[model samples]
Target: SQQGEEDPQALSIQEGENATMNCSYKTSINNLQWYRQNSGRGLVHLILIRSNEREKHSGRLRVTLDTSKKSSSLLITASRAADTASYFCATPGTGGFKTIFGAGTRLFVKA
Candidate 1:
């Protein structure tokens, strides 16, 4: 019901398979960012794709944004057991001083 809500709250995949997660937000944002956090660890910035850009990639990660639909998706290719973590999608809040994060998707990569 709130902004930056992610779907498929949990996912399990075997090593070497691709994992996908989706997030939907309600607002006009200049950019969207994705982050990964391991259990008991800090969040790591993954990627920040702008509103004007449709797609961006970093390493084995791919991010796609659709301003029209106010949605974004993250794809991890060739997932490894080490990649098991919680992924979150973030967007800047009013005045750009705050960041709203989605509930996050928990990924379990089995070896």
Candidate 2:
């Protein structure tokens, strides 16, 4: 079953600007996580927000969750050209060891 679906298939922003991405899930989840992929590189865990937690932050990254809405959002502040990459929201899959990922939002930060 599909878990996370990200909005805004793509995004383009200027360096130093903020970038926002949202994700919606079909079923309930124990925890939701966000990740960033810089082109060919692997996914780097950005932040995680548990169902019980309403919001969490790490550096310039902020994550918010609303269990009632089965949704989550990620915000990146002062984004730079290096921030240009694909961002994905993920949830655990049916298999405990596996994870399901959203299609991702491809972000382009212009220098």
Candidate 3:
């Protein structure tokens, strides 16, 4: 049931610093996706990495997957105040219509 869990429930970083968050899942998955939520708004897809992929990057975001350990990590380089938001990991369900999300890592990028 509980698919993923992200550590250090909250993080605070300087504007130019880097932020790193880790996620661990309980079961096997086809793929894992990371999303960003700005305040109360909807989530925006950040990146997706398949089970076979080791690492993926997008702009200031870098994601790494380790299926053997059932874990993933997201690194945000040169963080900005705009990047201050909650980051969540989602994994599609077996049926594909539903997705499970970790509680999330709340990031605070001080301007």
Query: Which candidate gets the maximum lDDT versus the true structure?
Result: 1
User: Scored by Cα lDDT, where does model 1 land?
Assistant: 0.96
Q: Candidate 2 — which residues are off by over 4 angstroms?
A: none
lDDT of 2 by residue, 1-111 (tens): 668999888999999999999999988889999999998899999988999999999999999999999999999999989889999999988758879999999999999
TM-score of 3: 0.96
Ranking by lDDT: 1, 3, 2
Q: In candidate 1, where is summed lDDT lowest over 10 consecutive residues?
A: 1-10
lDDT of 2 at 51: 94
TM-score of decoy 1: 0.97
Candidate 1 positional error at 103, Å: 0.2
Off by over 4 Å in 1: none
The residue-by-residue lDDT of candidate 3 on 17-90, one tens digit each, is: 99999999988998999999999899999999999899999998999999999999999999999999999998
Q: Which pairs of residues clash in candidate 3, taking residues 3 or more apart in a chain or in different chains? A: none
How big is the positional error of residue 6 in model 3, measured in Å on the Cα after superposition? Answer: 0.7
* 98 Cα displacement, candidate 3 (Å): 1.6
